[model samples]
Target: MSLEIRKIVRFEEETLIEGYKAAETPLRMFAVAAVVKNPWAGKYVEDLRPIVREYGPQLGELLTAKISELAGGAENIEAFGKAAVVGLDGEVEHASALIHTLHFGNHYREAVQAKSFLSFTNTRGPANAPISIPMMDKNDGGRRSHYLTLQFNINDAPCADEIVVVLGGASGGRPHHRIGDRYQELKELGHDIENPAAV
Candidate 1:
């Protein structure tokens, strides 16, 4: 069981304009993706756990390092996310198996010291299909300003038996976050932030 990586793709953006307001410095967001052969493409395997587990750390280390480098560094990161796209011949589960695992996602979370879970997407598609990676504040899921989604497409990937795995990072939160923080919402509602279910 091995991931025959075909290629690695990276997309980056630095925004100076958010609607009308200008950011003092551009807000940076980036994603790094890998196109690899799906080991269980056409089989209905009752057990995907072992294969999932085996690939997790290998991809986690590779992708986390690439994304961190693209975003500047792990310390510069303020938000994070991940996503995957499986080729038409593969099941959606094949896409999900690579990303929806602690073995894979934990590497990025730990690298950025993010307490929040990595937001994700998984689907089956052809080459050049749109892929989106949803993100949140590394340390606080409730931080609305840090909630972001990075999107990109690979022109030639997931060719019926491959999967595209992605990792995303942001250098800063929304440039013009006027809605207020999660703590403010908790305070206004007289709700304790510690126990959110009570709210």
Candidate 2:
């Protein structure tokens, strides 16, 4: 499996106003996505789960750093505001990787609350499809784990400026994939993936 990470920066005047109005402080809104290979689909793979599990945290850190750079700097980062992590066709397992990566205290705990992250599963077809994921719980660990595409959205975070987006694929002995191209296409076509004004 292969993983490709992509970052999109959108400047929205309204988002900035909204963030300031809501938080009563200077803020910025940004959207991020990660595309990775699905190890559970196509082939009857074994033991690859650990690979994703181990790399999940590392990927999340990378994403957070990237977001900080996009936001200008960590000191300038006021909030995460909104975010999304979507896995394209053939990679539903990638969703778990993302969930495990951003699970409250896992990464930006002090910056983003546990309840601010949302998760969705089983998304297949075009990589640029519009996505809607309802808010989810940080402690409700009862969700079933399955093989299918997945998506995630996060909102009302204080570390939006420093948030990094990561897409990871199988390490070493696996093929790599690139889904950033499709995300870029969707962005150019007017998809509401990024909230530039939220901060």
- The clash tally of candidate 2 reads 24
What digit string (tens of lDDT, one per residue) describes model 2 on residues 1-199? 3443333433321222332344233223333444443434444445555656655665566555555555455444322322333333334443444454443224643333333333333333344444332222232222211111213333321121122233211001101212333335546776644552232
**Per-residue alpha-carbon lDDT of model 1 for 10-125, expressed as tens digits?**
99988999989899768999999999999988778888899889999999999999988887689999988999999998999999999999999999989998888888899899
Clashes of each: 0, 24
| Candidate number with greatest TM-score | 1
Q: Per-candidate TM vs. native?
A: 0.95, 0.43
Per-candidate alpha-carbon RMSD to the true structure? 1.3, 17.1
Q: What C-alpha lDDT, on a 0 to 100 scale, does residue 144 get in candidate 2?
A: 19
- As for model 1, its CA RMSD to the true structure in angstroms is 1.3
